[model samples]
Target chain A: MYVTLKDGIHDPQGKAVKDALSVLGFNGVEQVRVGKYFELDIAETSLETAGPLVNGMCDQLLANTVIEKYRYELIEK
Target chain B: MYVTLKDGIHDPQGKAVKDALSVLGFNGVEQVRVGKYFELDIAETSLETAGPLVNGMCDQLLANTVIEKYRYELIEK
Candidate 1:
């Protein structure tokens, strides 16, 4: 799962990181947007059941949909 | 760039998310590891130059090599 702040939203954390990089002498950096990524180990389930399940999980738990958005990809293990 | 906690590292934040998921009835999750993803818009440059540059940025500022490691993919735009 990846949860990123909506476009046009201020990302102070990313700004801080970019600033730090500039201070470290990396001048080519034009912009930086930071987001959260998650690796989830889940029990085996059908894709049909897993899609809504994970969507619910993201909307209800992992991300704040009002200010951020999330997308997930599932791989069977 | 993707920055993830090294294996065996304790992640209380990920643990809290897992616990919350369990309490919210999404119990199929066995593990949750959280990480950071960075989308960087950098000046157009040759891949050879970009590779070492981004690696240096990650090592020096984006990730703490002691506990976190980072990998990045470059795309021309």
Candidate 2:
């Protein structure tokens, strides 16, 4: 699962990126925002098992109950 | 950029999920892991501009200097 700060949230990391841009001489840069990513491995071969399992992971662990939100995609290897 | 703990690292959130599963009567559940996600809107129209810019965002802010790793994909609206 991947979790991130929802839109309209203050992002300290994004602020730092803006600051770095000015330092790197990248002028006219206005803003930045950051988020999270995840890659998961599941024993199940079907979405029926994977979807609910992953969603439960998101609700229980991948996302912060206070501010951030989460989403995920399953990849088959 | 989306950032997450490198594999083999202990994930506290994953641990919590395991705990929750047991509470919720999911006895066979073994593990859980979490990560970050981002959706970016860029003024640029090409990968040449978007790629470096997004990477800079990742290195400067989106990812922690220690423990986590990150990757991202571009989405067009």
For lDDT, the strongest prediction is: 1
For candidate 2, give the docking quality class from DockQ.
acceptable
**Per-chain TM-score of chain B, candidate 2?**
0.81
Model 2 misplacement above 4 A = A2-45, A53-71
Model 1 C-alpha lDDT per residue in residues A1-77, reported as the tens digit of each score:
99999999999988988899899888888899999999888885787888898899999989999999888898886
Report, for every candidate in turn, its global Cα lDDT versus the true structure: 0.90, 0.68
Q: Interface RMSD (Å), each candidate?
A: 0.8, 3.8
Q: Chain A TM-score per candidate?
A: 0.94, 0.81
In terms of DockQ, which candidate is strongest?
1
Q: How many residue pairs clash in each candidate at the backbone level?
A: 0, 3
Question: What TM-score does candidate 2 reach?
Answer: 0.62
Candidate 1 residue lDDT tens string, B1-77: 88999999998888988999999999998899999999999995687789999989888888999999788998988
- Model 2 residue B36 CA deviation in Å: 2.0
